[model samples]
Target: MTGRRLTSLLAYVTTAATGASLLTGCGVLPGATGGSREPVTVMTWAPDQTRATNMPGMPAMAQAYARWVNSQGGLDGHELRVITCNEQNTSAGAADCARRAVRENAVAVVGSYSQNGRAFMAPLEAAGIPYIGGYGISEDEFTSPLSYPVNGGQASLIAGHGMQLAESCRKVSLVRPDTIAGDKLPGLLNSGLRKASHRSAIDIPALEDAAEYSQQADRARTKAGREDGCVTAVLGERTQTFFDSFRRLPTGAADGDAKGEEGGKDGKEPAVRISSVLGSVGQPVIDRTGGAHSPFEGAYVTGWYPEAADKSWAPMRKVIQEHAFADNRVDPADAGVQTTWIAYTVLKEVVEGLDQDTITAAKISHALDRGARIDTGGLTPTLRWKYEDLLGAPGFPRIVNHEVTFQVVRQGRLVAQKPGFVDVGETVLSAP
Candidate 1:
């Protein structure tokens, strides 16, 4: 072969081996292109190998979704190309990811996870890129005009968690990260409690990346009282650690001798029930901590979406089984992964609605703004982004889905405590 042909062959072999495209900051899926349609590129970013909360599954799921869509002759005859980045759980890293998306000319940033929303949102907004289906950890996800969040963000989860606890918990203690974002949780929780005439939860701020939360756990236990009291932590990855410390307390000796994974028979020892949101405590966490014998056996978990076992997730599971079976990082049960799936669903629908030969970030945003109805196959309410459809809640006016599901860990599985979604738009509006 000639020199030019040999060099091109070498580049092709290297690209196939690494699964990266020649396009800057992109990893095009194998066989993602079809027909004569132009490929629509998007980006997904989440923290990995971080001291704080990491959502490696979010980006992994995005790639898997792209593969599945492309396998089915692409989305509306247009190839779906997904570029992933590690946000590193820092402001600088988030800004870098957004800049990369801009540099790569990504039409949208879909189904991504990042706590530093402000850092990322500015760049995407400046580039006129629409952000879809964020994991809802940051305030900017709800407040930014360019951000089309699929969920109500952390604001709804904490508020809905307070409502879920109000039904059974006589006294509630909340242990959260001692950061600016954490400062808003207490008031949101209290607002939901007031709906049931319940008193405010005792706010206990703790380090988000602490190795162990023994001191905060002890304080939470003390503040929660003995009977019908509940302790809820929203410390992301450290939530499991906090619960571990909570269960190892001297007061838990009464239930120590229990055999098998069915440990929490009549609820936790010392009678303080544990609780948390879906992102902090999930099926993966429960399975890791001993399934049915987990410290969260009877824990109350508030979630933006339905339980993983719900039939609504059948499509997502199918995609994962086919495209991401070898990739262990993509867990269908993970909230971050689930959010990415929903976000991409929105992207596909919005793109199809445009029905244009050329797709652009401005066009996608305009299509969403003009009320492109997105049905997430029952995972969430039919999503629409019209100006009138927004919840208009304080600090989260762009929130369209104020519904949350109340879930419980039973026999190593997270199941719905109540059927259907509970609308917390009113509670969120009442928050300080």
Candidate 2:
């Protein structure tokens, strides 16, 4: 069969299986049968060996959370089965995974790590499945109710951070990848900075189409230089190329080496800081850039998870270390894993609250819309659904009563530079 034909046929099969599973509750059918117990299937990218190897802590963190959930008696006495698959970072793989989850009769699907969540979004919505922890801050994903995003929107983070920076400097330079996520950040940052003060100059590079790092970095540095001391913050990935270009610039070098005295030639060196709001996703790459090459000493980043210093995260951290990191011998740098775990926890709580023998997509949606709040005991912020917010958009519902925190990466380690959580207020996006 042709590829398109095959995909359509598979989708049909999956729909049929899902229907059967909802009806029979028997294990005989492909996706049918929760098998005597309610099933909650988590679909996330299988650990990428290349990325995981460099960051050995992630897989372990995911495993720990899965094991802990199973030990906790699972959702409604049903053992949770985590069905992870590698998407190869492709849309096709994500679509296939979404179909399989629905076909398999999963009460709720939790996870589609990174931007790959975009591919499964439509299918899950069509299937009426509730999704958690997948969509980033992309405008397209912000309007969908089928998806529940635990991580605050990326654009919100960029805007919040940019507003903070605009306080110190009037000029800002944004360095971002050429991807959709990268493209959206600059606009968000500019909007926020402009709101804070009308004098801010935002310089975004034209490297969206560039193929090589050297080219992108050169362009970014040129923009940085023109701003002079007025530029206060440098927001982007702290890659080796970024640092190399930044250090070559007279201002960057002076800021890095300057003691009590100012670093720039004019004794007014700009505060050149680099940030990647995605945190752990950017850490490995940041680490690879080498401390000598990339000095993030005074740079700040916005992250979804709390810093290790936050005592609030103790319970979550303990669980990860004891169950997830114990067998794997990994540290807690895998922010994605923690996010996945938190998403699953919320899903389990929402599902268990249904108090129904059999679960349906409509029922699950209702429970979430009722403003269910899953508390991770301060390990993470509270995630609650506001159905009223759902009416405004299509993707994940806009988070209400949410808090944001910022951290600085100093000497290759993340430090909680900001004091407490700052409320960004409600994020209401324009219709897509």
Scored by CA lDDT, what does every candidate get?
Answer: 0.88, 0.55
* Cα error of candidate 1 at position 392, Å: 1.2
Q: Candidate 1: which pairs clash?
A: none
Instruction: Give the 10-residue window scoring lowest on summed lDDT in candidate 1.
Output: 253-262
Residue-level lDDT of model 2, residues 225-326, one tens digit each, is 433322222223234344455545443342333221123345343344444464423455445556423454445666666775567656666787667644
Q: List the residue pairs that clash in candidate 2.
A: 21-32, 31-103, 31-104, 46-85, 64-324, 143-394, 143-395, 144-394, 144-395
**Candidate 1: where is the Cα deviation over 4 Å?**
1-34, 252-270
Q: What clash count goes with each model?
A: 0, 9
Error of 1 at 327 (Å): 0.7
Which stretches of candidate 2 lie above 4 Å from their native place?
1-36, 46-60, 135-137, 198-212, 226-241, 244-271, 280-294, 325-331, 356-361, 379-381, 389-397, 426-432
Per residue, candidate 1 scores C-alpha lDDT tens digits across 30-60 of: 4434244577989999999999998999989
